[model samples]
Target: MDGKKALYYAAIAIAVLIGVGIVISVISALVTLVSTVISAAISLAVLAGIVYVAYKAGSWLLGSDDSPSMDSIGSGSSTSVDAGTSRQDRLRQQYVEGQISEAEFERRIGEELETEEIDDIDRELERER
Candidate 1:
């Protein structure tokens, strides 16, 4: 998304620059106003076309603009594993290193994995059934 925004802003900047150049040249008598304006419009139009084409190509090749796939993968989601360490191992290390107590580690691990905590009332209902 950031990349797309940057690319889009860059395209707009380039088009505006070209248009301004045309206007400047016309005012300086380097070219007739009508011809210069026409040329600027054409140049801007061409740049607009290029931007659209680039966006389409990027989206088609990368997936949705907001979720463009990384070039290395070419397709699909990329996983970052803290650069490839196991979650279980990391948790264990935290415990071993005294960074977290056993209860805290267990609580955090459960939360991270979205494990549900059954309330006492829910447990009683299950037992009754």
Candidate 2:
């Protein structure tokens, strides 16, 4: 009877493993399908942009100014186009200019990260309050 009970448990375990495998296979197939669809959509969008740009160039050559402006092609924000220095960019610039030692630059960046984290936490606390 004990041997029979052991076989029963082993069979149950095998069945459960098979069921899990089937579920994983189905989920993987679904994810692959979704990824393919997204890729196709992005490809179509890029192709459309290229065609539109070509049409605009043709129109411009024929003496028309109906093409979208450069701002429309990229981020239209003036602030983003300005000489803004990110933390990493500033660190690199300082190191390159001999204004800071490598170790000091790293330390400053680490401190900046900590400060940003603290600021984020404070902001969240304020929001909650």
- Per-residue lDDT tens digits of candidate 1, residues 1-129? 999999999999999999999988878785576788999999999999999999988987777765434553542112332222357678889999999999998987786554223443455587799
Return the clash pairs for model 2, or none. none
lDDT values of the candidates?
Answer: 0.72, 0.79
Which sections of candidate 1 miss by over 4 Å?
1-31, 65-129
Pairs that collide, model 1: none
Tens digit of per-residue lDDT, candidate 2, span 9-119:
999999999999999999999999999999999999999999999988888888677545565467433332232236668888999999999899889878877766676
TM-score of each: 0.28, 0.49
CA lDDT for candidate 1: 0.72
At residue 17, what lDDT does model 2 achieve? 100
Could you tell me how far off, in angstroms, the CA of residue 44 lies in candidate 1 after the best superposition? 0.3
Among these predictions, the greatest lDDT belongs to: 2
